[model samples]
Target: MDPGANWWEALSAIGTVLAVLVSVAVAIREVARARAAESALEDERRQRLAEQRRGIAALVTAWAESQYEPSPDGTHYVRRVIAHVANESTEPAFNLNVVLAYGSPLIQLGPLSIPVPIHVLPARQARSWDVSPGFAAHSTGVGQVPTDPIASISFEDSRGVAWTRGYDGKLQEGGGHQAISPDSETGEAQIGPLDSPFNPIAVVTAFHSALESATTVQDLKPLLSPTATGWSALTNEELVALRDEHAAYGLAAHVWYPTPRIAYVRLIHDDDIERARKGDSARALVVTLVFLVGKGWRVFSSGGAVTEPDWIKFPRKDLLRDLRG
Candidate 1:
């Protein structure tokens, strides 16, 4: 055999092997590029879906209106908070429920903070519901003072996607159905609780009886929880003011329970009837009694149109004068 012919065969074999290596490299690069494109498309799809979900929730809005008024039973004063929800989008919202939650430090009595479900909210229309019948103010012994009246709301958009609108008005996906209770009745959302361990009405009556019999502020100390806001370190001036208040109001005329753990005692004054006859029906003091888990029921707070001292920002003397009136 010729040596040059053998050399030619060797060169051809090298060329075939090089071509196979280049083909394999090209195929690998193509596969990597295809995978990167597919990943980018998947990310875009998820982002678009998220934006659509957020947009649907953003179209729903909620606000609240509140005022001090007599409770439904005409027994005691209560701060009635009405929640107004509106669906601005053309699509109706479904399973629209509102959960009135206390942030912290404020004790929720019974199931008062349960979800208030509104089956459906029509598009471009607004509806209002009283959400604060069993709500309590700042606990004299517990957490931060209650400020914002509005609570967190949840709903489902037309596409059946769950969404939550927080108290801060930010809309987010999921958490919409977390507030719904399995035991809720099939009809309208109820305002009051069905069961509790203690009777708040009887507790309030007993508290008032003890309050009326006390001859001095020191004697009244036992009627309050030891953890009450200023009850432990009450100044001499504060004691005198409380004594005068007790002397003027005497005892509660009527009592009502906003929850199984809270009672509102109506302390009608001497001239309250005359004031009411004159159309000034907001003159009496409403003492709040809260049931503590280990300590039972005690006076937690009090307020009136004239002597709402915590909210009035008035001097002590002026507050006492208004209390007497």
Candidate 2:
């Protein structure tokens, strides 16, 4: 063997090793770029959410402009109503319109409407007009929208979304609200306290429903309680793991309302980490299994054994008090 030939072979091997090192460096760079891109995306989402919440807040006030006297047991009933709008927001509310929807046989109305020209309600301002040909009446309690009213109030937000109060006393968003006994009243629809469209129980159920049928966990983001921490809003890694695991075993869950103030949720199936470590998905596990009704129904805490859900021992409280005798 010539020494020169050996030198050429050695040079060729070194070149090959250098090429391999370059390829490795490029691969590592690409991975870092991908991670940075994901981090930026997550940051953008959080920023958008924060900005949206900071936009504006508006709701119809529930101050009783009542006309009814006390009950036999001396319970002051709210029969008359003054449907009004209040802006408890920093952002001025514009393009406001309140529509009244009613039904016949069960109720009666042609639908009354009130519009604000140059429509704007300054922060801490309110619109209180005698909206009572007859709004709904609560036999008892504060400014209560009637469940069995001849007509119901539907209104629009500056965001171009129409909403009505739900049975759970939260606003439900659609385009319009359907009055009780939808005979001729069918425009937009939402729930009310008499028939809540998305109660704490329902909101929790919808969250699980999204997990059961959604491609992205972000769909469950809106349902998460504002106070939720840790895994409630999963980080990128947790989300990926869940997506991978859930693909293997179709996830199913249900939210049960033990009380208006509390909700209990349980996962029927999921690839829980404990089970995965044990090489089994047979045992059921918790996926945000408990919810308490805060301002809205939100995930209080999650993760418990399906066999013995220690959290189920708690009691539920009534969020709304019906003083109707």
Candidate 3:
């Protein structure tokens, strides 16, 4: 009856089908495992790159001189920028280049085309380059590169991997990226953001401005904290008087944030230069202000007090401590 032949043939056919199915299932599992492994590798690469980026903390600062230079265009207040940079990093940076940026309200445009000379800085070392800002020639109004200017800088690690950072001059990290072009001569590689801080002179300038420009109590209100632990901003009358007296001000060297919300802005009364000498006249005073969250910078200290902590007594020592080498 050929029974044995049929039964054996059917069994053989079934075994072959089972073998092919098993092969396909195993191949599918292998493909999935490969994809999972590749995804893990990509994640690990990202982590390693982040660690590399953390090695470099390049900072640029805007240090305004006490004496304000008169710009040919009297409408603008121009000041010299002692653009300083330091490598607070673990590695050496070479072929380092710094460029001053110009734009209104950061994140709008990119960096300016003007490039400062390149230099080399090692870890923990700092170097200074001078730039005069607010000049209509170099910077364009809207207050010549807002108060917060981008000091776009780039450098290659000892290994030649290029990195770029856009320092907003206030120590806040702006745009930064890796895998930048290594060629310094080309016009292709440039700083990230071209935005500027509206007030370049920092809080003290802002304070002096509020004082100089305030004509009435209503005009002076925005610059002061009417209800604070230390209501120390200039009295409405004081602000009006300063404007009338042409009260010149020498911004204090340091703007310290005693607390995140509270900032201490110190200034020397230069209305009478000689009288403002260390012990002469009022000498110096501080205004403690509160930083209104998401609104703006520190609210003017309430009292309009003319005295500061022990720090202000020694201007040379406390001035520009944040930018110190």
The alpha-carbon deviation from the true structure for residue 109 of candidate 3, after best TM-score superposition, in angstroms, is 18
Candidate 1 deviation (Cα RMSD) = 18.5
TM-score of 3: 0.34
User: How well does candidate 1 score on lDDT at residue 186?
Assistant: 23
**Best by lDDT, which number?**
1
Please report the candidate that would top TM-score against the real structure: 1
lDDT of 1 by residue, 68-181 (tens): 776445666656656677888878888876654343332222223233467888888887654453443222223645454555677888888888887667877887653332
Candidate 1: residue 101 Cα off by (Å): 5.0
Q: State the lDDT of candidate 3 residue by residue for 265-312, as single tens digits.
A: 545666644453332456455665543422333344423462333322
What TM-score fits each model? Answer: 0.43, 0.35, 0.34
Using lDDT, rank the candidates from best to worst. 1, 3, 2
The segments of candidate 1 whose C-alpha lies over 4 angstroms from its true place after superposition are: 67-81, 89-91, 101-116, 122-124, 130-148, 158-160, 178-325
Candidate 1 residue pairs that clash: 105-143
Question: Which model is ahead, 2 or 3, in terms of TM-score?
Answer: 2
What is the lDDT, from 0 to 100, of the residue 224 in candidate 2?
60
